[model samples]
Target: MEFFSKLLFLHEVASSHGKGLDELLIYVHLLMASLFVGWLAFFVIAVFKHRRSVNPKADYVGARSHFSTYAEIGVAAIEGLLLLGFAVPLWAKSVDKFPEEKDATVIQIMGQQFAWNAHYAGPDGKWGKQDVKFASSTNPFGLDSGDAGAKDDITCLREKFLIPVGKEVICKISSMDVIHCFKLPRMRVTQDAIPGMSIPVHFKPTKVGDYTITCAQLCGNLHSTMRGEFKVVEQAEFDKWFAEKAKAGGGGGFE
Candidate 1:
């Protein structure tokens, strides 16, 4: 039952990701499925037709056919073409470009056991200053107190990420503990949050809705609880939400 639900969940996500690379991925799946069905059918037919009751004689002679050789070569050629023509190009294109800087929003994502900590760079559009030595339960980022630029930066800890739809959003991710995977299916983005290192990733959501954000990494026993949602709203609504969150003593406490 769990596997069945998981499949349905994946189907829903796959439907959303279809707006991106999932389309091609589905094509590849169809090709592989067709090939597998053909192979399985041939295997069953061969077993039945070549059985002792059917043929009564095992012949090693005349087993080698020109068609078999041609089939093998053709399968190899098709696989090679798919790898070179589809697989390589898609991977290359996905990782090749970053969002243009103009009018883009940057959000910092810090992964911890069973939760996510988010930080907005304030209006300064900079990380300000960070001090790893001073980090604790209170100062999760270990932000240097002396840094004037980091003074007004906003921070939060929660199970959700909120952003404006149709705007480019860049997420810089890092983990405080073990490695964790940050996944947003609708945006077609997933990146690993390695401890002590930041990974830059970006995406633009065309749809205005709420999408699930799940941690794909099997972090620990509590990994299942590391689920979240990203809300894509209009610009005015997002601004109002952020303003209200900040006014209510930061989003961390508000949540």
Candidate 2:
């Protein structure tokens, strides 16, 4: 059953909201298909019945039946219902119902020219102070070394972002250079990472696996190469991985 579901979706369904998003997409496409077929059938019937030999002359008043008018009104009503019923509510759930910081795994994603930097507030649960002056190739995040909160901060470069499954991940996204769009297709999550502004994007991973994070915007020449790996693992494995990164001084390099 699970295999069949995977085949139907094609992409891996890892986020808690993935099923709802997929249902919405399916419903929209089905509506479009139904409308297309109905219009095509109507066109073919009109062409056959209104041929030059059949009608002999053009009727300015056309088919006096109000059926086409009723059909157009019906289609409008269905579209209005879809917007009010599904689209609005889904948008509210994603934007208004954000998870609390204390209850969620919060991290920072800083976008640079050709790379993504993932910053995790280590065991202390506090982020280090950062400054533009301190920014460098090796220290892309510009951690203030003197700050005690920064001692255990983990910065993962080369796009190895790891999170535990079944937990809410609240990512604070920002850009160091130009604008970039942080996109995770399977999760149905996409947000703009604007320079000098931090935006929060939240999602709960429902499965343990690997996924890809790609920039959906055209930033620069290397935008195509601005891809990253996202790994969802068990809680224990995530803890161990974070611990090791912290112990190793928590500064990753670009590939």
Candidate 3:
């Protein structure tokens, strides 16, 4: 009952991007379960029927049947097709760049050894100029000074990312140190935040709630503690919260 409840909850919570993937996942699970049941039944029946005591003259053939060979081929083909047709596409959609849309909220995600630093693009929508050589307590991103767009940006190492529900959010992710993955299971998203590269994941929360963002990759000693969350709120409330954070002073890198 508990497992079924979780599955149902997942289905309900993930109606948008997760529905199709979940259906395909269920189909694959059912197929595998059926195969397991059939194998178990066949093996049990064979063992009982061909017992040494019951059939002292039983044929000791070790070779499998032609049907088994064809079954193996069929299973392989199905797995290949499912991976190529379903999983690959879902994965691509999750990590690919967000579509160009006006007024889209841009969030920068910086992954470090044991924390996630989330930064907003601010009102400019374009990151202020940065000098890569400038590295210190004040300039963590090593912004290239010549790139004039990065100056007024606000950044925060906030424990939770707050965004408006129903608004399209594009998260641009990068890593400061080693490779780390941004994983949001309920959102049907997981992508590597690699050093020197930015990956984007776009989504609009259908419901307002707090969702976890966990590091999927093992990076360091405290990798397990590297976690974060985001709150999906109404547009007006989100704007207020964003403003408060900005007023408090934000910190992180932008490009």
Candidate 4:
């Protein structure tokens, strides 16, 4: 199963919740394959057994046995179990079990036509005031220069963001223009970035490495270029990186 998953290009599990998603995907594929093979076998048997040279009698009442009905009921039961027992619970956990802000590394992501603008609240742990009127090519976050919290804020373009491994990281996602999707395959995280709405998604990176961040939605002609990097590191390394950015004035402008 692991080999097949890798062969299918599934990303390695790098989060606590990622294994559950991987298992669910593998189970779904297994169920689908079983159904396909079962149907193919039945079709082949019917073709050979009911051929003219064999059972020439065409019975008016076809398939008098209750096996097909039982099979259909069984399939429905399995589907219901997969939905209620797995899918629904996973969704509820992802949407409702959000970590506390104080305990999580919080960041903001704003999506434009073909780029992701990432913002960190710095040591203050409070987001700065933003207004669309202040938006510019250089200042995509629209941060108000007069706001005190805005001074220490860090902003990065094209999705170069960092998070500490083994810590809960929450991202508040929004869009400046059309709808976009933020996808981190290794973390099993995907959320839509909608304009005028800020949606939160959280995950815990179990490994320290670079992960690909891609826009799963086609927002514009340049949507294919909407790619970013997510680097997971140790807590001390993450702190060092943040300190360096802070010392450099914390993403004062586009870079």
Candidate 5:
């Protein structure tokens, strides 16, 4: 599967569910390859059997056979099985069957015209009070200054956020202005950030390393440059960083 993934130009899979997704991709590709070969072979056979030299007159009723009908049915059946058996189940796991909140790292991500913003709940695990009224260029999250929860909330604007490796990370994605897609390639996670709607996607980063966060949509002129980052570090390292950020009043890491 690794070789096949590389052949298909897929990035390294870091999320737990990534393997399943890769497998599904390979299956779909194999199906397509089979169809391509079958059609090509049929075309060659048809041309050879109906050549002008072999048959001067065109047959009004072309070769009539149940083979084509059966082949079409078989192809549709395979496609249906792939969707119902594999794709739907994987999508359900990502969007519906979430890990417990206490055991997972929950972060709120807001997409703007050309940048990704992340907001963490700090040590309390309680989100800060936010309102559209308080939102501004400096404070993209609209974090209420007077709210106690807001005081310790950590915000990273166009900056890297940190999460411990081997833990489920749930990101609630929303758009500050235009529609955007939050995509983590290595993690095999992609979720749309739509205005007035917070969509959630989860992934467990198994490897400890720096991974990129990119806007997968053509949000604006700078959409290609809309990039953020995150680090999957050891638990102890994440704890230290979290505490330091909290002590510093959740430093504004606007880049």
Candidate 6:
């Protein structure tokens, strides 16, 4: 599986569930490859067998053997197994299953024209009050100044964010403007960010390192610049950073 994954040019797996996704990809591709070769062979055989010189007359009655029907059924069964036995189970186990908030890192990420905004509830485990009226270029989270919960919340604008390694991170993704796709290739995570909607997705980071975030959608003129950064670090390092960001009052803005 590793050899096939590398051959398919998949990035290094950073999330706990990434290898499963990679394996599914490899299997799907291998099935497609097999179908391609087999169909090509049949095409060549048909052309040669039905050549004009070999059979000048056209046969109106096309009678085929039951072998073809059985083959088709066999292919369909294999595909069903791939979907039911592997794909569906993986989706259920990795995607549908949600880790408890108390045991996970929950954050909100908003996508704008050419950047990302990340919001954290801080160490208090309480999210700040947010109103669309208070939302602006600098205050993407729309945090109410009068709300005590807002005081300790952390917001990082177009900057790198940190998550503890070996912990599940639940990201609530949203789009401030047009539709965008939040993609983390190494973690095998991708979720569509649509306006007026917040979608939640979770992935457990397994490797401690820096990872790149990309917008898979063609957003706008500067879509290519819609990039973000993520760092998976030790629990202590993440805690220290989180504490400092909270102490900074979670104030975020463009310079």
Whose TM-score is greatest here? 6
**Residue ranges of candidate 4 with Cα displaced over 4 Å:** 55-57
lDDT of each: 0.72, 0.83, 0.71, 0.86, 0.88, 0.90
Q: What TM-score, to 2 decimals, does candidate 5 have? A: 0.95
Residue-by-residue lDDT tens digits, candidate 6, 148-189: 887788899889999999999999999888999999999999
A best-first ranking of the candidates according to their TM-score comes to 6, 5, 4, 2, 1, 3
**TM-score for each predicted model, relative to the true structure:** 0.84, 0.91, 0.79, 0.94, 0.95, 0.96
**lDDT tens string, model 1, 178-208?**
9999987656788998989989987776678
| Clash count, candidate 1 | 0
> How many clashing pairs per prediction, in order?
0, 0, 19, 0, 0, 0
List candidate 2 stretches off by more than 4 Å: 1-10, 251-255
Candidate 5, residues 47-81: lDDT per residue as tens digits?
A: 99989999999899976889999999999999999
Q: Is candidate 3 or candidate 5 better by TM-score?
A: 5
* Candidate 1: worst-modelled 10 consecutive residues by lDDT: 11-20
Alpha-carbon shift of residue 107 in model 5 (angstroms): 0.4
TM-score between model 6 and native: 0.96
Query: Which of the predicted structures, 2 or 3, would earn the higher lDDT when compared with the native?
Result: 2
The segments of candidate 3 whose C-alpha lies over 4 angstroms from its true place after superposition are 1-15, 58-81, 88-97, 101-103, 135-139, 143-148, 247-255
lDDT score for candidate 5 against the true structure: 0.88
lDDT for each residue of candidate 2 in 1-255, tens digit (9 for 90 to 100): 345445456476679887777766666766788999999999999899889998897899878889999999999998888888988898788666999999899989888778777999888888888887877777777788877788888888765878999999999998888999999887878899998899999999988888888898999999999987889999999999999988887544411
Q: Is candidate 1 or candidate 6 better by TM-score?
A: 6
| Every model: Cα RMSD to truth | 4.3, 2.7, 3.9, 1.8, 1.8, 1.5
**lDDT winner among the candidates?**
6
Error of 4 at 99 (Å): 0.6
What's the lDDT of the predicted structure labeled candidate 1? 0.72
